[model samples]
Target chain A: MVLILKKQVLRRLITIRSFSYDKWYKVESERQKRINKKAQDFVKDKSVFDLFKFVTKEGVSEFKKFVQEFKETDNKNYKPYLEHGDFDYLYKFNTKEDIENWLVSSDSGYKIGKTKASLNLTQQNTGLFSGYLSSDYDKPEKSKAIYTGYANISSLTEQKSFKRENRINIDQFNCFMLKIRGDGRTYMMVLNTPSKYTLTYTYMHMFPLYTRGGPYWQYVKIPFSKFFHASHGRISDKQYRFEGLDVKSIGITCMDGVEGPFSLEIDHIGVLKDNESTEHFAYETYKIPKYISNT
Target chain B: MARRLLTLNLQLTSLNALACRRLLSSASNDDKSLKKVEKTEEKILQKYLRKIRPKDEEEKEEEERKGPFKNYFEDEERNKSAIVFYEEYFDKNTKQKDRDNFMSALEAFRVTNPTKNLYLDFIYGALLKMKEYNAHTHLEAYRKLMEIFPIGPIKCLTKWQRDNMHFPRHQNCAIQILEQMERNGVILDEDFVRLTIKIFGDWTHVVRKAKRQLYWLPKFKNSNPYPIPSIEKLENMKDIEIAFAALERMCMSADNATRIEAYFTDDLEEKTKDNFESTWIVTAQSQKQAELLKDHKKSIPIFVEGPFITWIRSKMVEYFVMKTDPDPEIIEKIKQNENYDDLDQNFKNLHNMFNDPFRDEFSKNKKSDLSVHELTDGTIFALCCTGTGTKTSLFYWTKILEKQISELKDFIIVYKIKPKPSFLVDLDKLKNDFKENQQKSN
Candidate 1:
């Protein structure tokens, strides 16, 4: 089943654009192997029916619809939306129901011991992502593995049809803005953008979100150009500018390695074009010089 | 008696036979038999050695019995425990818990425990005590702590030694010190780099951690938009003074029209029978927000919400906001005034409106660009962080505001206070708590 999905995504990628396909395919396969290895550490093997425990009945229908859309749609009709000229909220946490739009998960659920994280509304009606992060892991028998702590609150990815993601086009905006109250901790805000490869070759652009913890709500304006592409927690050597054409979701991750209670209260998230910022991309997109060659 | 002697003689002869078999096995050089003979010989040798070096074995047993740490409180005549020692050395020796005293404590511990047996315990203990002395933020304390570990010998010299984690416990402790320094937002200097290299060598993990700190710390040190004063300065300033600085930062406006007002609670007209120490209230109001407060309807009640928390560095300060409910009529007007920012949505709406002859209303021109100030569900008038987050204190806040905006006198203000539970209520703390408890019981 996973193989079929992989082929479908690869086909879509090849149809849309051209690249060094063989090299990317190698990198993607290597990444998939690493993921599978990590997954195997927790469970011996996952059968096809075991996948149903995660993918619901509705998910199957969604996949079917996605396949149908995949057949019909092309690069021309991909995520066509009017460009936002002014500030508009992508996600607003004004009420209890608004908090439901985000899904919270942590390493604890994957048999990692003791760490717990959750998201809920505070008395002030803001979404409070709070929990204790513990580094202690329940060691499996004869396993030489170390489990670190990580808890993330990710916004749900919307799918219009059989589409992988109902991409929100905010190309007109330059800055991603949010109002948040945090406990003086640094968080990583990861932007999920569509890539030409499989899910393994995820194009995640992340930037540090430094929060000044206090009573006052801080309005942070991070330029989209500041985001640098990273996959599997490591930045790519060949960097590229962040194109906000098909943004799917944003994830806020807390993994500072501090073992204690943490909290982040979010008011709203939006996008705007800051007139002051002149730099197109914070990091250089040119290929880094390699001193050594395999040949 | 004869039968027992015969049995003893047979056992001695068998021992001789085994010794003979060992000799024969060595001569023959048969692999399996030679291996079996060597194993028995090793067992006999181990038994012989145990008997020979009984004192050395006893000393090792004694060392193991003491566990991972040495008991510094072994001197029972004076009965000075570790806690008492800390109190005497840190508290009684110096009244001021400054960097000097902190270093002196480390010096004193080193002098007393010269053997440095289980030094990791001492380092861990010192780390816990450093927090109480506020020495966790001091670079000198970390330097002193790092200096406590004897250098040179523990340093991993070769690549193999570095890879295998030579002196792992000590290296980890050093990394932990660096981590704590990072946590306290301490910027490590070049002098510290030299010290780390000298102590742990260039290739050691401790040096790598220090190098990482040196690289990353400077980048994020000045990144905070609302930067607080140094811990040294904050340690000296009063709570109210700190609150003023924080409130000033929080209420900082781009136009520079935000006015800060401070007054003592004792200055209020309403006084209680029992006079206690007065607390200061630091309130901030912008000129535009003050104008909005004046124009607010007298019939509509204003809400003073929150005992919200904001951190001025590590110190927590509770604050309140005075705001009016967002009127739906005004919200609707704002909505009608707002333009569809999406070009496609505007085009579609225009097409629909043009096609229908009966539809007369077109997209209205945007009234004004929506600023962050208008993004709130409620219009905030003023903000304040007070020493006491009580209804009476908030009422005094309104009374103070009434002097600035006279129209506030006619408005009915409602306090939505959810103050944190603290011990200090008044001079007679117990009595009021008892009364509140009784009221709750009813």
Candidate 2:
């Protein structure tokens, strides 16, 4: 009886093992079927759009020629200052005497600390904004003792073309390229719009010097879309978009809180108009009102 | 007897021979019949096995045929077949899943045929144009293609990185993939983040949005704990003071401040601390200026050079310091009770008072009636001086100090100049004596 019982147990075990094997095989085959279906579907879908075509050399030259033609025929509306290599409108502080007419000096130490800034022509006759910053945390309890030195392309002066009414039409340009040499410190490019009877808020773009402590010149290209709006040293919650024509002034500031002397050299500043430029407003987060309804 | 025995033996032998012959005949007949039955059973078993085995064999064969390519020749054949499949099924209504399958198959082909893989670029271009394709699908196809032919997609990404320009749809798709990867707990490399930023961070709006989303990514948040405020939240805020205050709150959150401090270098950390301190001082100064401006009918020159400004600054500091410090007695009482809901409500009230002082004063007054004794002397002074009635201050104080003051419910707390004399000593005679002394001096 014991032998018979043992034989029965062996037979049952064999049957269970076979049953599990069959189940596993079914699962694997089902998975393979799904993968096969996906593979087959992938082969069934391929088409190309016109935008995928690479821009060739001839295409670029042709586009430039077209832009030139557009400028020449439409001279009154189209002004290509940098495209034609026109440096007449470009602001250059070639000598110490010329600095007064072209730029205004601002330093935070004048009010609280002992920060001083000087603008001098380089030995190479290039425009330079150099400054000494000191942090005096002892004078007042609430004093930050920070010193900042900056120079603005004064729009209030005798240059009528640089006035608020005669602002450059940025809609026709792609970007502003500045040839600058700096000492690795971060710098800010500030632009202001014309306001009546009140101080206008400035829009600023802060970028760091790619190379530091070297005399090598770096050409920095800043698009108008990169500037963020600020008023009185505070970032604004609302960003107001203005056309290139609306810009009244441009300036550069360095205030990284590194207590030492800093220097920045300027070679030239100009605008470039490239057809390949993506013109859509880069910031898509700003809300746009659907309609101007009278309340 | 011998004769009889021999005869018996002969008889037995004959009987035995007869029995043996009969047994042999029967056994042979039985064997023949058993053999026929066994052949029929074997034939039936073969038929049953044939019926069940074909289905499994066909499935196995199909899988083997579609499995990974064995050699370059097989890969080439598969590629050609895939091309034909694509050409045949290429239509506007072709589903995204079908395109993905074809790309995957081509990927498998490319894996086997690694050299001279030019067909992938064509497929990628075509996939780029498909409206049904999104960032995830595009990413999957790109990744598979990369696995087989790593050079193609890398080259494409490099070109896009160099030009710093991408179609809006492509850019959006890349952002979506990055977000999805992050959501799945995948830690993306810095290069991926940098590439995404390069492609989409050009516009102010995109950068603002990306900054918030990227800040939460494990890579960004782990490295830098600063909470990036959303542009919508910042833009909707009308007051700069309130906005900066909100920023301060975010910076000071328990999970963030320590991590952010660790992220900053020594010098940067010092500067950041100074900046925060200065911001609070500036806020306090501004609040004082606003309060002063509100009191006078005419505009006043609040920025007096000498001691006046310093005095105002000191006062502002004092007010802020007093306002921020919670009463220890009340805190102890709250801790003892462990009534967290009441504590949270009290904190809410404090925040409301900080945000807007006058909008819901009446409602606050009604709520404050039950808890008035918690008011510190300095708080009462500030409330009265600021023209928020004594009753409101008492009410606000009680809410915070309810538990502490419950024992003192029977006592009426008030400011007393001097204790009343036990007996009435001032009489008309004392007044007359003082008057006579005054007359004598005159």
Candidate 3:
């Protein structure tokens, strides 16, 4: 047993290169490189005294946090910067700068998966959202369930706390409209509702965005009522109508698990007032069961 | 030294004599009792032999026994693997590890551990083992696994108990089973519902999950707009046929004039033939697109773009599109007509608009054909996903299109193919470099 243990120790000391570890190291080094670049940019614009002031400010904040035992920040007076405009266009990807309003993230940063989301310019000056989606990832050592391959671009959420969020009231509009051209891939349109409880238990709804693969843009108008209540990628047992008045933000997600290149060009996202058709909610919503009530 | 050795030998002999005398005295007192003691000793030796190497008779008897968990629980090595259907069941001589074997294993485990106390570990082990056995896809397997949980007296009686979930571990185990089934795209049924209610009680979280799946799963099961045939049907179909079906579904319109055709690469003229083996080219073009193609000016270049993916369920088909450059005049016309103000404004002046019927007729006359192919980027003439995404295969498609629309022959087609990966290009160079390095070493 002693000899076996000694062999194991020596084997561990050799540091065999593993795919997951190499990928994790690559991501870490890239992050470090970005930080260095940002530092260089900071130095280019500022004097040494300005750098000292910035460092001191950061140090003072850290000292304050230490003294206070790192309490929860109460930003009750923080105002959201995203403008509230006419319901004609909630999000318009007209220029390269418009990409900043949308945050892109995927499983690659967290796991040994490979995915990317970037802005490409189309001839129409529309933002072409393209990505290489891959589900092939290193499985965790002890886990039986493996999950990866999801790429998302979400509008920036403006919130001070779980209770307070920058919500736009689109109660008048019955349908959510988008003008987009895609390569016939299905995407999910996610609408966030303000969380009444903890952020861990988020309340959101999603519907499939089916794009017709062609040269022309397709105007898809999905009824707000068609959005189903789904939480953390699972459909909720208790069905509820989407609360349009308490809307927080919207997002687009591609997680079909088909590894290939995908592109979707967006002209704009708008809310339409459809007067001809009248449907409240697509799914049935009854009274909550007695068991859930007890909870 | 000799005297000391003799004295030690005498002492040893005296102790042996003393032990013999005590045994003789005991035997003289009760002869029958001494015989009985000897019989018991022989019986114990036989039992130890049986324990060391159990015969086929013993193993069969163990199988016949209803509750054989006592032996299984006592065995440390068997407990570590945690599979109730031991190596004997999955041996080379026995049946293969499949759905039936998996079901039988669950049945055997349930039959043995009737009054189950430490069943949570077994359930978890079975859950992980389901994937290895490839039984996760079967609804019947999930049903049988759920039936493993014992019912009746353990059922929750009160609302609070049910809400808090009586036997929370067991209920959670059942939930994980259902979640696994969902991940594998298995729909819950009436049998599943009955089992959930019977084992976990009606108001428990497990039952609620079942109800949710029942309500939602079927609603979206056939919800794919570009629906292909069922997965089983698609399995037997040729790749070209499946691709054509997906193309047909995507190009389906109310007009019913969309032409979908498949061409074989070998059928092409000898001058254009590129592959030794035949490949297929499936193309779809609507009447509107054909008309648009005819109206295109010959001076401008038409671009053949893509290798773009369109997922028809799990299958990813790559198709190319024939398109023209974005026309600014057409974009401006589209922009001018996108006014929602006219929709609401018409209702306000309903009487005035109705009084002048000629004005309404004029507006109706000016209305253009609404096609998804007409866009600011360009007008799409046709789309085709080939067996091989090569320029030659695409050329056959354009030739086919040319026969239908003669105007396509006059237009210059430009190919904008995405370049092959750098590694593929560098492989030959790397081979040469390796050869040079080997020569230098020599």
Candidate 4:
């Protein structure tokens, strides 16, 4: 019996070992890397799924040209975040400068330091906002700024855009901070050159508003048509690209630009770029057909 | 006697010769024509040499006396295919270990003669269940049986599915099936990914749990790296990292440190804390700020971790000492909590930490409960008294602070519970009296 059982068992083990499989080892980070590679390959692979890939080189350039040349609206506050090359960063300034990311509520009411503070010395120089100044440093130029600040907000009285300029020329591209009331977080929008300047580019330099904080996680979407119409001075159905740029990422300016008596906290900042959204690349791609038609 | 003896001897010799020839020749013969005649003639002397079972006559009598053959396999054929059958069934029925041992007997039997279906089924089921089914050694067995029977992956998968009928929808069935599928060379495909996604569906819910279980789940060797990413894959990976970390931490075993290096997605290479810490702190600070502003609460403590809290406590102490007899209760509370432990070696962060103690204190204590106007009033009051305050005579202090804080244009009347003439109108006097009053009351 012992011999029988032993023989049977030994035979089974040896037999089973025949089918025993060896396992291949894989780690997660490696897997993630592979996933990314596969996705990229799948996206770029001509035969597989390249139909949905982002716009390529010529497409980007042409879109920029169209945005610069043909925008359709002039409403001043149609703010937008556009992609650009590298990114626009301003010169760091005095730590104690009284600037804010965007305006929330200032206790009694009204946006203090909401309007760009002009230099008492001359019309040119104004209080600093967080951005690079042209040689016109002391000389005031109307521009929306992303600045650091120190104020515990009571509420955000206003979320609507304020008119910045009637006519916006594509002379400059900028990246700035926006202190929105929803969640009372600082939002950063990087505006590349090919933007609908009059409306899409207004809020960055437009004056501030005060309102109670409500609708914490809500996001607002306005018609892109209105945005296009704002590029012409005020209200004419103007078309302007104000073009030229590429942007890698749009996020909150990494540094704490506001150094008042207190540390100004910043929340996340990103652009909601998607299909149908008018990014520089998207605009350029649309313009190619136009350029072809003209020729 | 001689004539008679000779005649008898001749008869005996002839008979013996004939009998011997028949015995030797007809051992391989077909018929028994001579056996019928010989049996009637009573050739009983050869009865001892006839073929019989290996039982003793007495034992057979005893067995017959006792009962019929206890089992057919216990008969004379015990050494033949009967023993093979008995060995396979008994080994498997008794214990797993025993079945394993009987495999050789079964093999040896097969080597001698192929066992029929009943015996074959017994051996195969036993081997498969014992999880001892081997491809190489049992390759012949596997192949032979497969040729005889068309049940492979389906049998195993179906059995598991039947067993776990109530196993929470597709969760366990999918697992068991896929595992078996992997066992067979189904070739891992998107179906496996789909099954996983189907079982867990949206990554949002189980991203954490699956990430953890994934550490234990055998990971295939593949990687993903790129500039831009897939929307779908991104959705899948959204919360997988945390889940992965948790899985890694939980799945530690002796050899796991090595084995799970593959499962753990965390980079083995060291990352500088500088970038990560600053980002974390900034993110947390901003989150806190958002929470405070939207909710109208204190913004500083959003990132109030141990070090930050400790710094705040120490700053509170400094602020307390910066003036004479600062609220003892507040100082005492800080001392008791010992919120300060191992912290910034130096006090560089003091400014951000409790720099505005009165406002910070009021924000903590009041805004959480008060209406907007009440909150603003307390803040304004604290600000004038503590804002740029100097340690001077109490009388002058009250006069200065009172003059300043009274300018607030915003007001909401709050019902005070003070006793007769207990309240002081002068904001600065109010601060002094309130402190003394709180101390006395406590």
Question: Between candidates 2 and 3, which one is better according to lDDT?
Answer: 3
List each candidate's DockQ score: 0.08, 0.01, 0.12, 0.01
- TM-score between candidate 2 and the true structure: 0.28
A best-first ranking of the candidates according to their TM-score comes to 3, 1, 2, 4
Fnat of candidate 2, please? 0.00
Q: Which pairs clash in model 1? A: A65-A162, A66-A162, A214-B309, A214-B310, A214-B311, A215-B309, A215-B310
- Candidate 1, superposed: residue stretches over 4 Å from native: A1-63, A75-98, A105-151, A156-174, A179-188, A191-206, A210-219, A225-249, A253-295, B1-99, B112-117, B266-277, B333-364, B369-376, B419-442
- CAPRI-wise, candidate 3 is incorrect
lDDT of model number 1: 0.69
- Expressed as tens digits, the lDDT of each residue in B1-442 for candidate 3 is 9999998898678656754665566546565655665887899999989767846886555433312123333345445334443433333323667777888877776777677645655665566567667777688888877776777866888887976778775676787788778767789898789877887678678888888788788998877665657655665688988788778766773236888888886676664534543678888888888888887888999999876666665677777888988788778766644542254545321111112334456445444555667777677788888887888778778888878887777778899887552212344588999999999999
In model 2, which runs have C-alpha deviations exceeding 4 angstroms? A1-89, A108-110, A137-156, A159-171, A197-211, A240-242, A288-295, B1-442
Scored by Cα lDDT, where does model 4 land?
0.29
RMSD value for candidate 4: 36.4
Q: What is the iRMSD in Å for candidate 3?
A: 17.9
Candidate 4, residues A1-295: lDDT per residue as tens digits?
9857865885588468762211111133357899999888776785433433334544466566556544534432343343222122131112323223233322112221321211111121222222211111121123222122322221112211221222323223322222222211122222222245554442211111211111111123221222222221121112343232222112122111221111122222212222343444211112322211111
> Each candidate's chain B TM-score?
0.67, 0.20, 0.62, 0.17
Deviation (Å) of B234 in candidate 1: 2.0
Model 3 steric clash pairs: none
Q: Which 10 residues in a row give candidate 1 chain B its minimum summed lDDT?
A: B348-357
